[model samples]
Target chain A: MTHAVSNGLLASDLVKNFGSVSVLKNINFSMNADEAVGIVGPNGAGKTTLLSALAGAFQLDQGSILLNNQDVTEKCASARCNLGVVRTHQIPKPFDGMTVFENVLVAASYGVDADKQTAYQHTLNAIQLSGMEHVANRQAESLGLLDRKRLELARALATQPKILLLDEIAGGLTEAESVQLVDTIKELRRQGIGIIWIEHIVHVLLQVAERLICMDSGEIIADGEPQAVLSNPQVVKAYLGGGIE
Target chain B: MSQWTNSVTIQRWTPSSRYAIVFAGLVLVLLALAPLFASNGLLDRLTALFIYVILAAMWNALAGYGGLISVGQQAFFGLGAYFTIRIADLGLDPFISVALAALIVGVISYPISLVMLRLKGGEFAIGMWVVASILHLMVNLDGLIQGETGISLVSLNHYDSAQRLTIIYLLTLGSMAGLLALLFFVLRSKTGSAIQAIRDNEEAATSVGVKPEKTKQLLFVIAAFGIGVAGALWLTSATTFLPKTYFSVQWSAYMIFMVLVGGIGKFEGAILGAIIFFLVETWFSSTGVWYLVSLGAIAIAFSLFLPKGIWGELERRFNWHFLPVGYQVVEKNKINTDKK
Candidate 1:
């Protein structure tokens, strides 16, 4: 096992299995603060599962997760969120009954444990950052696809996370919408929040990702600079079989 | 050059909510002053209405906001009455026993909630009924209760009928008001948001740092406490301690009916539904089985036509919020940049 960084995220020998199938096998990953890393993989490559593990959605069957050198493998999802590890769902899951502002406020209030005034401020700022200020008072269930996706991002942002795990937040959007999401992610990178983004859209990932990791059959096949990893023979064959357009 | 900036303000009250506050104050004043002028019969009916309100509000907070959808709250209600009787037997004033009994129910419900709250959806609903049945059987085993023969709070015979009527009325009214106010403030607080968030989507709520189990447990315990008080208050009025009467599934049915008819999730809807149910029972209860049949029919109709409930429809159409338990973000200014 490599030494855990005191100011970043680290995972070593991570193993997760579902019944007899090993969804994630011996996964070793690490990222520094403010580093923007993108992950691309074929279907069933365990990208989402990896994000879920890091976010503490469920306990790992093996290995460990370290957030800022704090062993967080045993912590629950909410505790990890409070510890500054937050994630957005691949499929947007807003609190349908709550307004956009209220949805974000939940994260600010509980995720960061901000007081009322500070939570309100953070909620407003997150809404503004996600370009959702216009519909801040609108019911979350009433949002269109793009707005819903933005809401997912805004909610995660309100957590004031040290490390953000984004799972295909830009999926199923038009090219223009994708570009807009990329711009927001770029801004987040500028603010020095460590990000591990998983997206199938190779071009969008290249826009904000300085480093890239490619996975095949639940194993990291290539890890390095975005262009280098994308062009790796194993990655091209496993993920981008038709080659990047 | 002039520059514009947007300032966001968080406010809970709108014009409708302000009007609602004034209206609620007026109603409370009238209810408080009722015993002075109201007849014993009128006071008796009003007390029943208060109990119904308590039951509806408690169930609404549990199933509507917390998403527990328990069908066994009667367990606490029955326990409350039984404990009140037991405490009175131990030399405490029965009136004081009511409060003490409800507190005991709250304490015991924590452990119960830990076990029962693990069951979800239909399992939770039926599991609660089973728990109620178990408690009912346990109470039956007590020699003092005398099984189906039942027991009565004979200690209350010391008060004259008029005095008993007035005291019970005041007690029930005061409790109903206090519980409503408590619900209002709780729904407005951050904890209120946590429970509602859990109801919306438990997994999503957890990812945002809201502990679903802990939040649900708190709500469950509170609902049990309030329902227990309602049960004890009901016993005070009836002056009877029939386990069959207090622990019946009918109480849970009534709660479900009121909450569903009024609007399942809306705070005002529960109150409105309780009032409607109370009025319906007062008018049509003489019709025998048809009255219950009609209630079932109304609940089904409401479920089919207005799943959000009557209050939910009204809110959607007229944009009225009698109890604004959520935040509204007001954009103070809009910035416009002309061609540079």
Candidate 2:
């Protein structure tokens, strides 16, 4: 893939709250176009919330996000996606009434406002890349869990995203299936699509992610090279209460 | 961009579909010349059938593919009818006034939508009905509306029953065909794709750069436009325009019945449903109130047993579209092959 004109996504001092409860607390994050960052933490550590903020799913209380050096905190989710920020739900949200091909075709056509031929070409590429060509015409609701997850990835990829925010796409998968998903993520990372993946499967994440960040209570407790950050005492303490997992 | 790509032919219809096209075209030709041979009474029934189709198609497009269920479409229909007579009274050409009335009603929907679209699902349906009620009351207040006392179409007095029915029949056919074609093509375009996405899941659509509000707004206005024009034509043919009858909620009820019993999202379902409805009304009118009751019962039965509507059921079983609009992907080499 051709290099993006600027560095990838950047978020600074992001704070978000739902009513009286704060979900994300003063989080600062950044990723380069060539990097894959894995986020590991205990349940409810705000990893998904952080991803949501970046994805423009919800407005933050106070924060700024930059995409390729342009401020995008004010942009809506659709606009963010058009600017190449795409996300997949933890539970797949495929357009149920549509065929798998149509679900992805919507992304290809609207994600970048591509013409018919370009959208068709992009949809084909995305479906093939995510290994969904076999069931391309099947109604999305008919897909099993594994195929649904693959379609989620395919839909995101169809947008030609520069950054993919994956939220536990590996969740509920068998070991072999998890490894297969890792392979897809690895391929995307190799193609220079920056990835921010929130996954509990540390080993699978390790295969694809070049860096690791651990969060606790909506704030990152550790961030650095994958192995080093995973070995950090703060992260260890956060994960297992002062014991290593 | 490439020479090899130039040799590719984008397949639009299958062999059977091509045949269906020819047959449908011939039928349209026959219908266009219908007034030439048909009696006045038959021509009148045909005009009523045409109006029902126009209304049903508008409702289906809005509630089906657009996912904007609105019972308020009568607001435009009533507004269109009233505007037509009023504009005709102002000494403008009666033909041009109907078009103008349709345009005006469409404009009115822009603001009405701002207020009505805030409600979702069933609430949206009710909200539109409430708006129609307001329009019904407001039109009744106008002196020109003659309230329930009514007024005649100034243009009809210039022509006899045969000429008038012929003119209205021809006009209704042209408008219904034109609007349905436009709507069908729209459903095949990118906007159709986005509308379907919004219908499925607004959040997912937003993830892929579709603005749900903007797309829904477009559909709401388009529906208003078609219903508006249909209202104008219906009034033009009827000659007598009573605000109470013109702005009746029964129009909305009929529209909902047609689409719900026909198939909500599919194009042909609306047409088929309208045809069935027209047949029922004509054949069973001798039974009086029982006819309306039977219509209601059939609609309920269809909703329960054939939830997808009759045409939708047929399409599912046959895997076919009599009027294909929304696009489906087929591999280039397997273009002519049917899905299993």
Candidate 3:
């Protein structure tokens, strides 16, 4: 049950461009250990692209990322994961042929180099944490949308990450389910895991995140206390005509 | 302590006992008495069936369990045969030659996987074919195998045809059982889960910290090793290693047909497919190229109509599997403590 405190993450002057189109421009951000931050933006605000860069899923066109006081800008995704950085996808990508238990089992074994018995117990804990124990024996492909999201969370959590990057986990969930997920995230925060949640469900973010940042055109428009950030004039302008009020 | 002990005992037998029993029974029967029926042509055909079983199972492990569809296994098979011939010329026993040849082929295949693993989907499949063609041409150019004339295995000259055939058959059976057992152990391990995860979804697997490229490369090498052993055993029985026969595209085609017809992922499906394939070959061998045509037709039919293959269909219907690779925790004897 012991959790390591991450030395926090720092991204300086981050920039990414796909062909002639600039997706992220001169982005600077930092999140401390035990901090829960929520990222909100429009559909094409490059929220996912930023998450991918932080997770080292792809190389950044320019900028440096430091995790725990070490430069990890050139590290691969697996190397970042081994350094206790993990991220889930906006779209759940559960292994189709694997059962829920097996999916988590792989994470526990390879993510931290735990022995078989310990890995098995960790896998069980992850399944229990995700509230997916009932479907552990079922193939992941057979799961519904909510269960797929749960499986995605379970797989990420089983890696025993110090920093958990959640991308739109509550995006497509029902109101009740989003509330339940918010509770889970709150519990994880209580356990001292740093979480960066990218969510379209503003209410869920409001419930769990102490800090909130709004992005427009891939640049942070507002950053502060959740209430203050949500109420900022620039944030209001970005979500204009989208009914933020 | 009593509760802990009880749970441990239950865990011991819960998941894998039935499969272990079934696999043990099959191996015992095959090893103990299969040679007793050696008088008929049955042993000869069964030997071939065993070789196909190994080949098909190796392919299944690559594509089904590991999600790597390779059409270049014939390259290793041909290398194994040619190496066996070379080893025999150096005065080695045929059995030792098979092992030596397998080793050499395994080493050669490691570098090959690096190049082949870069291609994905249809590109990967065609890349395998291209590798096979290159290897075929290279082996053909080597005059030691007499190009198309084929090389007669010199070491088997002492044994009569039937004796040699029997020994070769036993060797193949033993190799098949060993390889199957190795695969069963691998599939039961955490590595197997990672491989299965990669097969299901590579991006998900990477998210979970499974290195897909490393896993695929290891599986590629292991599969090549198994195919190489099968090749050496095949040449020993035939007492000849013709570059044309050894390096033919037909070897790859036959393996694909076997796995596709029987079942791709299931271990026993490979055995079942191999037996069915050899039986069909026996019946249709007299039809010349029509045999290949018929095989192709059957493969197409299975691909279109029964995409999961024959054993897969049967498994779905009956919920039966001889080699079960995954574990399940069963809740037994749940006590209502509060009611009690």
Query: Which candidate's DockQ is highest?
Result: 1
Model 2 stretches with alpha carbons more than 4 Å out = A1-6, A240-245, B1-12
- DockQ, structure candidate 3: 0.48
RMSD score of candidate 3 (Å):
4.2
Please name the candidate that would achieve the greatest lDDT relative to the true structure: 1
Better of 2 and 3 by DockQ: 2
Using DockQ as the yardstick, the better of models 1 and 3 is 1
Worst 10 residues of 3 chain A by lDDT: A1-10
Best by TM-score: 1
Candidate 3, A105-219: lDDT as tens digits: 8889888879888887777778778888678778888999999999888888889999999999997899888877887777788889999999888877878888898899989
lDDT of 2 at B209: 87
lDDT of 2 by residue, B1-340 (tens): 2222332323456665667778878988999999889998888888889889999999998988878888778889988899999999998877788899999988988888887878899999988888999988988898987778988887767777677778888988888888888898888888898988898889989998888888888889999999999999999888788878877888988998898788889888999899988988888879988887887888888888998898889889998766776555565666765453
Tens digits of lDDT, candidate 3, B1-340: 1232233211223223465567677866766476666564777777888899899989989888888887778888988998898887788987788899999999998998898898897788778878877887888887777778888888787877777777877888888888988887888788888889988888767766889888888899889999999899898878788877877788888888988999887776777888899889888889998888999999999989998799899777865554767755334453211110
Residue B254 CA displacement from its true place in model 2, Å:
1.3
Sort the candidates on lDDT, descending order: 1, 2, 3
In order, the Cα lDDT scores of the candidates are 0.89, 0.85, 0.82
Please give the TM-score of chain B in predicted model 1.
0.95
TM-score of chain B of 3: 0.89
Clashes of each: 0, 0, 0
